[model samples]
Target: MSFITINNIWQEYGDHVVLERLNLQIKEGEFCSMVGASGCGKSTFLRLLLGQEKPSRGTITLDGKRLVAEPDSHRGVVFQRYSVFPHLSVLDNVAIGLELPQSPLLGRLFGAKKRAAREQAAEMLKKVGLGHALDKYPAQLSGGMQQRLAIAQAFIMQPRVLLLDEPFGALDPGIRKEMHAL
Candidate 1:
């Protein structure tokens, strides 16, 4: 069976239609890419696949189950625009995703757990070439740096399915190559 299935999917906003009769099947451990002109609903389709929005018609299934109507940890997403928290320091931004799911009540991890989470976040940031900017706020970083931080944040969760929208558009060629290696 397909790992992800999109059948007769359509997304329409009011009188306008963004996607029409979109169908796809992806096997387990497959990588798929969507290419189209701007405003052709690629991002919108990603959002739908992430369960951030339900299609105006049709259904999406992951592992033979209907996708939930809301976002969940089973999927991670890096939007085309940077989605890091502007108020958070770079390290905290990445660590928060790890902390929240493990400790939902406090929205944090304490003691050694906290330390481990931070360490993991730091390692991911380092892989993305942001090791020196751990204490810096998102607003203080360049657009490419912020986007890299966002990537680190999304990946640290180790979600079963990852959705990226123009995830490397802001990076330099060298940095993009480094990111692709991950």
Candidate 2:
């Protein structure tokens, strides 16, 4: 059996049907891509898998367990726009997820734990080629750099599944290729 399964899925908003009777299976450690014209069900399918939206019919299961309706640390996501925090520095933004599990109310990671999170965030950003922009605010970076930061932020959490929603929509070809390499 596959690790992720979508069985006879259906999604709709009032009278508009986005997805209908879709069946898919994804195995562990496998890479899958979805391609279609704009306004197709690609984003909807990703959202369903992420539990951002529930199926109007049928079921989605991960590892044989039905997916719940809420966002959680088990899933990571990067949207095309507004993925980064404008107020936080790049390093701080990347470390936010690392801090969350330590304290739900305050996220008061300090001393070595804080430093370790910062180091890991730096490594992740460097992997995505954003090391030099660690101290810069999101608004100070270019569109492509911002997207890289978003990817790093998502990756730092080490989520079981990563969902990207048109993340490369605004990048030029060269930047897009670089992002693909990361």
Candidate 3:
């Protein structure tokens, strides 16, 4: 069975239609990419996959079960724009993902849990070449660096499915290539 199945999906916003007659099946460990002109529903489709929106018609199933229209740890996304918190340091931005899931009420981890989360965030940042900028804020970094920070933030969650929306658009060729590898 497919890992993800989109059956005759359609997306409509009142009088306007964003997507139509879209069907897809993805096997486990498979990679897929969608390309189209602007305003053509690529992001909309991604949002559906992320469970941020429900399609107007048809159904989407993940791992043979109906997909829920709510965000969960199973999926991680990096938007075209940097989604990192400008007020937080790079390390904290990434670490917050780890902290929130475990402490939804207080929205924080205390003592050793907090330290472990930060350490894990630091390790992920190092993998994305942002280790040196751990103390910097999003505003202090360049566009490409900020994009990498967003990627690190998403990756720190270790989600089952990762969705990237023009994530490398701000990166130079070298950095873009490195991100593809990472």
lDDT minimum window of 10 residues, candidate 1: 79-88
lDDT of candidate 1 at residue 99, scale 0 to 100: 94
Q: 1-182, model 3: which lDDT tens digit per residue?
A: 99999999999999999999999999987889999999899999999999999999999998998988898888899988768798999999999999998999999999999999999999999998999999999999999999999999888888878898999999999989999988
Number of backbone-clashing residue pairs for each candidate, in the order shown: 0, 0, 0
Clashing pairs in 3: none
By lDDT, the candidates rank as 1, 3, 2
lDDT of 1 at 9: 98
Tens-place lDDT per residue, model 1, 1-182, is: 89999999999999999999999999988889999999999999998998878899999999999999888888999999868888889999999998998998999999999999999999999999999999999999999999999999889988889899999999999999998888
Between candidates 1 and 2, which one is better according to TM-score?
A: 1
**Best-fitting candidate, scored by TM-score:** 3
Candidate 2: where is the Cα deviation over 4 Å?
172-175
TM-score (C-alpha, index-matched) for candidate 1: 0.96
Question: What lDDT is reached at residue 169 by model 2?
Answer: 79
